[model samples]
Target chain A: MLKISKKADYALMALQHIAAVQFGDVTPGRVVNTKEIAEEYNIPLELLAKVLQTLAKNALIESHNGPKGGYLLARRAHQITIAQILESIEGPLGITDCSHEKDGEFCMQRENCHIRTPLLKVQDSIAQLLNNMTLQDMMGGTPLITIQSPTAQGVER
Target chain B: MLKISKKADYALMALQHIAAVQFGDVTPGRVVNTKEIAEEYNIPLELLAKVLQTLAKNALIESHNGPKGGYLLARRAHQITIAQILESIEGPLGITDCSHEKDGEFCMQRENCHIRTPLLKVQDSIAQLLNNMTLQDMMGGTPLITIQSPTAQGVER
Candidate 1:
């Protein structure tokens, strides 16, 4: 399991596109509309548009409406984390239905399944790792940032 | 899309069952049969049997046949990692089909998807976190262990 939705992926692709362009451009938050991103990344326009809508609604990105309109990061690139982007596009991040206790005791699996508690721990670890990563870490010209154990501070550059 | 397969879930359930029992008095490396695990967890017998076969084959656990035969941890409970158990049941973990470069170059998505590289990094972070955790870390009686950012030198325990 542990898969990211294509919608989230597209959202990331679109954001990375804007982040890369804005890294040094004159337009500090200038819109870079969906059409241009979809074409450059070969993403399906309709699908990417939906993803963009979710991000815009979440205020992760700003959407413009005019003919010259497009999308731009609502915040600085480093202010955006992959976890926030994923949550905006795909809701909560859980690898399993029973990852949270509120999933209830309706199923028989609940009777003997001790995995739920541990699975939740797994979910937490994953969410922590995702939350730690900023979009700036993955954008073009930046080396992919590595994960530091939640407690490890500034050890692995 | 981040979901663990039923087989992997069952595998974790079975391992946890064995680990729980082993945590108590009885015998070290005590074997717990498939029928018992399957019935207790309401897992499909045939499916869990296949999952156990893969785990046994991968040496995550040992299996025996005949009436008194069943399965036991291949090593100490503390030595078995969740990543090992999951990978044994599900093969290599790839969050996306294109997670690995060997996914082939046939799809157009592979040609232009900027997300793949960064996604692979995300996958690596998940895998590393899982790899760092031993089955004993999740077994009953042990308080849920918190993640120590991968380099903290074991502070959180």
Candidate 2:
């Protein structure tokens, strides 16, 4: 089955939570504590902490240490797309192992494999959808259909 | 990036090859040698052998041992969809871990996760595509379009 990993899903949810509270007059650029996030979401503190640390390392979220420490979005809510979160947590959004151009060159049949073509199409479709969507979109209750509907009439909102 | 695993890709290719040859007196029930498949497609013999074995175990293909041994499609080529091949190799097709109704019950935010709905839609879209495409479609040279294209027209022919 093709599915996103738990870590990736958690990463997106955490990002959405941060985006949701961005309007509050909390300390500007203040770090959001992992404990608060975990408690609010009812997620496992330890696991979510690790996920946050990874996000920080990937520059998806900014982290601070010491007394007034926590995590904050490294960029604006609109600047961060779901693709970035997914890539930070789950590597690349490739559909086949051979679709990755950088490391994928090592595959035995990289040059002439017919399957990579369609798989690449699938990967690109998913990536484009993820890239075009922002944390704000997810928070605004904008269904993904708004961005993906084929008819131009549906896109005109 | 989303990508298909080697096992799944190889299974699709092997099935398509079988479908192509199954026309004209070649019954899908007849055994085919692994070496023949490997040599014809220039695939890695060892890896292809394991992939074929995996398919046979999943009931996608039937295999025999010894002289008259190889593999045959367990079902008609038209009856075997790409989704079945992918599931046989990778398990289930879902964009988020929470997309699975059975497994998603354990998620901490099962009661109110907003993102789950969109991810489920993405999962369903992918499922719909794979389910609509059969191994025979691939063998018949039905070109797969890039996901960016709204039309379902074949790419090559």
Candidate 3:
């Protein structure tokens, strides 16, 4: 199971709220504040604040300042991906410990391991599916990003 | 981080050893006991024993009883899949906690979640890739199974 961390979940929810508020046409220049989002979704303020900061630092969303200031999508919703958000919150998504490590680090199991290579293939497809899914696609918006086989892009399977 | 439990990794290693020893043609009808696999992979004997029992119970591998008693593949290598092994050890693979629960159970975030449906799409593709890949495919054997889109089979995307 590829466990999506709680913080990652919060981040996506927060972004969704911001995107809706900013782009819903109800409020053209409005920003979504953390308090409103946290209160609405019943997410913890401190945790949701930290998640928003991470997303801001990662450039997925931009922060605003003023009376009605908060956060807004830095780019179009379609430009952001679940992969980018998840990777920002968590680290890289590797199903196995050695799947992301090219040298296998100090893994003693590496030499005897025949499963690592195949598991890497599994991890790659996971990353691929994630990368192809945009925030717009996720919110029932237009699915502009299409799934492409990593192998088709000259990536070795 | 979709953490594959250490027990699941050990189970895969144990099965790989069994498949190689049993079907490598160097020795036919040989049974691979837990001790051999444990020592070869430097895995703990007690934990590996428990994992072997679970695999046996799942019928992914069969255990023999006698002077030559050990473990053998319950089916041919190509007949087994990583999805089967991982599920046998780690239950169903769901990216989100609520993705597998259609009714959302007692999850409070269900109503606020716009990501669940899209995450399900991601999870489905992950399952599709894992289901199509066999133990034999992992071992560099002829890939008799080809990848198929679940949606093409009339399963909803």
RMSD of each: 4.8, 5.3, 6.4
Report how closely model 2 matches the true complex, as a DockQ value. Answer: 0.31
2 or 3, which is superior by TM-score? 3
lDDT, residue B85, candidate 2: 90
How is the predicted docking of candidate 2 categorized under the CAPRI scheme? acceptable
Better by DockQ, candidate 3 or 1: 1
Which prediction has the highest DockQ against the true structure? 1
* Candidate 2, B4-103: lDDT as tens digits: 7767777877776776555525563466788887776678899999998888888988887899877777888778877889988888777776666684
Question: What shift in Å separates residue B83 of candidate 2 from its native position after superposition?
Answer: 1.4
Off by over 4 Å in 1: A26-29, A103-107, A111-113, A141-157, B27-30, B103-118, B140-157
User: What shift in Å separates residue B42 of candidate 3 from its native position after superposition?
Assistant: 2.1
Give the winner by TM-score: 3
Candidate 3 docking: what grade?
acceptable
| lDDT tens digits, residue span B118-153, model 1 | 777778777777777777766553222543345422
Highest lDDT among the candidates is held by which one? 3
Cα lDDT tens digits for candidate 2, A1-157: 7666777777877887776665445645446788887787778889998999889999988888888787778888878887788888878777776555584255654443445555554555556567776776776565554333211112211
Per-residue error (Å), model 3, residue A144: 7.5
